[model samples]
Target chain A: MARHVDVGDLVDRARQRQPRAVARLISLVEDASPQLRDVAAALAPHTGRAQVVGLTGSPGVGKSTTTSALVSAYRARGLRVGVLAVDPSSPFSGGALLGDRIRMQDHATDPDVFIRSMATRGHLGGMAWATPQALRVLDAAGFDVVLIETVGVGQSEVDVVALADTTLVLLAPGMGDGIQAAKAGILEIADVFVVNKADRDGAETTVRELKYMISLGRREVRGASWRQPICKTVAARAEGVEEVVAAVAEHRRWTESHGEFAERRRHRARTEVEAIALESLRARLSARHGEALDGLAGKVMAGDLDPYAAADSLIADIKAEG
Target chain B: MARHVDVGDLVDRARQRQPRAVARLISLVEDASPQLRDVAAALAPHTGRAQVVGLTGSPGVGKSTTTSALVSAYRARGLRVGVLAVDPSSPFSGGALLGDRIRMQDHATDPDVFIRSMATRGHLGGMAWATPQALRVLDAAGFDVVLIETVGVGQSEVDVVALADTTLVLLAPGMGDGIQAAKAGILEIADVFVVNKADRDGAETTVRELKYMISLGRREVRGASWRQPICKTVAARAEGVEEVVAAVAEHRRWTESHGEFAERRRHRARTEVEAIALESLRARLSARHGEALDGLAGKVMAGDLDPYAAADSLIADIKAEG
Candidate 1:
């Protein structure tokens, strides 16, 4: 029966600003149904319409509080906001602790704000296959801005969040080498850095360390003027939240004015589409030539041609046969 | 020129106990050459001749010290030992900090000891793709026991370590909630557990937590009598190293007595062979059918069909063409 639901109807209901309909569509996408993939493809045009702000850092960082504050700030200006919190819990568990959601309860009845927690679902490379799907749903549901907060500082999670329009990396004080998380891989990708819990001891030191790290990685592209911004915040008390919001607004304006936004979006589109293509090809190849692969593999194992050449020959044969 | 080197000469040198030749072959495997893969394949039958022990845990768990102590204990018993420390550092540097090497310096010049540090290069998975090649080299080098210590603990690194004959997960005191790393993914993969740095506080609590976690995950399968053993060690001081070694010996005996060794080795072989085959197919597909792939991908992204179905259809077409 769920399969019989026309993806078109779901998309239409979502576009009509029906929250339940959008939520249902998101569930379908999370399930990764073949039919829903079609719906998502159809719905993508509605996306690239929302300002995607990504938040990522170590687990204990107050990303949730910062996101909550941002949501309030966006709504206070009469803007509808969607928070797509990518929790690291297992989807098989069917739901997260929803701790991030609980923190955003101030907007529970706002109707102008939508808060949804997404599980990473153990997807390879960190971004859930369902993430793009969720983004589409939120876009169709009439959100002005989408805030995506992910769990950890690993390379894969950072890569996923880097797909966002404005990637904000959050840090906290006393993370003793917590800057290591940023310096390792995530720092280079961030558009805005936030030293959350700025009231804590060593907050100044953390900020300085992050500042030093950022400056170290910076290079002068003589003709182009682009410098990633850093902000400090005591997110729990909402101090400096306005500064972060303003920074994001400034970054957005700069990107739009410089035409960098369109270029970045196009680049992301091409990469995502290509990834889809590669996944498709791999699937096809595996299915069509399973046994031949096994046989050829045995030969390769037994003093045959190099794996690369064997692959080339197989592809040639496949193409010739086609 | 490098490919023309005779395998027999290399193998003869290795058999005659030449570490230089063994190191050269290991480097050859690390290069991931098709010819080297073929040579390693031919050498597979002569492999599984060494007791391969995998040491893994969170970073700073004193895995190196535990491994060093374990090696020292084995050598004290007159066993020929080889250490393959798989470092996930930059290969271009071609130098290890030798933190673990420092601990094991007593055996650096020992005639029966061969220690090699393998750097991760171009391997999609955590372990070096040339790991099997290195193992074969170590085997031919006549080492009775080859200890492969994988640096760091993540899903892929743990999987690589699990490939060993006996996987030992080392933990340390003050690893509060760090045991969460074990309760979930890497711990279940352990055949033997070693609590290193037991001299630190919370040692007793760490032990209790592991026991609880292990017991929770244990399956009482009918007709199967294997139980994973946990040992606490102050490896820096060589305390409890002998017990960890004894547990390892016991696990080996249990595996052999139950004929699990042959089955595990067979599974490993199948995995290695399949990887080789798929890798070969990927290269072949990319080179010969690269344009066809581009065409199909364009169509798929242009909203033609579901990628999985497109994949299915492509496979059918390939099989039909074949």
Candidate 2:
């Protein structure tokens, strides 16, 4: 077993806005250490402060550049910031490419900025399983803003919306059209849409298409009252990034004024709690009922039992064990 | 409650190769109807016969066209084929756009060719939860080959590999370089690489880059003895598609000769069983522990308890209730 981390010391240091301490707490959560329960208990009181913002787009759509620009803008406001990049490519250690790391090196030396990448290696639940805990660690660490970046690819990647108070869906010229956006389901999760690389040709066309798509009212409006704002940004040059940041802040204001802020956070908390409980039950079931499960699988394979019937029997066995 | 579906009648009709019966069985799996257990029990013996092949790529990578061509090729071989298009855009029903539906009209009238679209609307587990059951339905319904087609954009879309005997990763020229392929992790999941749209510019470059990447030996090499083959196809004109089909058959032969076929199926069965059990436990937990869960969520929200601790408490309560 790994040596026990000192939860109290870590909490105290994190409360003091120490990036190393915050990173350590997140590492514990990522590793799922035995002391995670104690760490969670220690940090609970300090959370629910940071505004969680999610940035997602198709790969090569300048998500990182836009994220970096947003970070700089937030830091310019003299607020502490935390970045959690859920990297699908590297699911083992949450490793970022050297180029990506160098791109964000502007904030690397700042003590008020904490950046961490999380890998989804063993997480079958995808971002739904690991992200909320990491967000809590950053939230408790006194960051005023937390930026969660994930590559928009498939269904589970959209879960970032569940964790963020504001979600920016990024697009670039020549990537695809409004039909592709609608097909990818990004329109549904986006609170603010950012058209990056605005200097490129067809930028205006992309903007027009996005505006038309938003006007369609096909997206499942979360709050039903907030109209999503579309902003164009040349993030590489830091142009229009401030406008994007301002739109995010406007969303925050809207949600708060409408009393959706607390409601959203409460819902997020409930989801996190439920996910944790479900994972725990699954872990216990596998650990204790390994043989029985194997037996059930054998029967299913042999056509003596269906998977549903086998599942019912397995659940019964777990209940009986309890 | 919906009336119980007659498992025996459905199975008999499906086994007789009735498209309506197969469709109904898949609908039950998608709706997660109560009679699904009986259906699975009846279908269990009839599965492990059809070859499950999964074709996935980014949107606009010609997945549907390639799928249609492959269906035609299999039909030419006098083999019945079933196509399941997991449409992300249409969540309520597994409905395809008119254009896509029309593209497959050639096979639509053939009774031996059963094509169904599955919506991922409410499924949080992605393909892991529903695709296997649907595959079982088709497999039991006497299809010689089941083509699983998904718009591969994100992480969870990779789950199709778990249910496929052979997974074909499709790419098109002008999409990107091998680096983008590596970033998407498609290279790892691909048992065979199909450079679709080979008539387009940079097709040779795409094929060469993919060959170089595969030569790097980065993929896990599942069976360890057989090397992945890269094939090029202009799926639109049906050129080179037969070669792709030949590659798929070669792979199947290799796996069978190496005894990897049965091994892969067994592994798939184990994963399917575990997922079902986990889903069942979650449903039961919500049904039985609603109030306790709500209380725990309240505590977590109020900061009186951390989510991890609350999750522990919730699990203990569940055990105690049992």
What lDDT would each prediction earn against the true structure?
0.65, 0.80
- Distance from true location, Cα of A207 in model 2, Å: 3.0
Find the candidate with the highest lDDT and give its number.
2
Candidate 2: tens digits of C-alpha lDDT, residues A151-234: 775776776556799999998887666656666667777889999989988899999988877777544467777888889999
The best candidate in terms of DockQ: 2
Among residues 3 or more apart in sequence or in different chains, the pairs in candidate 2 whose N, CA or C atoms overlap within 3 Å are A153-B153, A153-B154, A154-B154
Q: What lDDT is reached at residue B216 by model 2?
A: 67
Best prediction by TM-score: 2
Which segments of candidate 1 are over 4 A away from where they belong?
A: A17-19, A52-162, A166-267, A274-322, B1-8, B11-17, B58-155, B169-197, B201-240, B253-266, B274-322
Candidate 1 chain A weakest ten by summed lDDT: A89-98
Docking class of 1: incorrect
Q: What lDDT does candidate 2 reach at residue B313?
A: 75
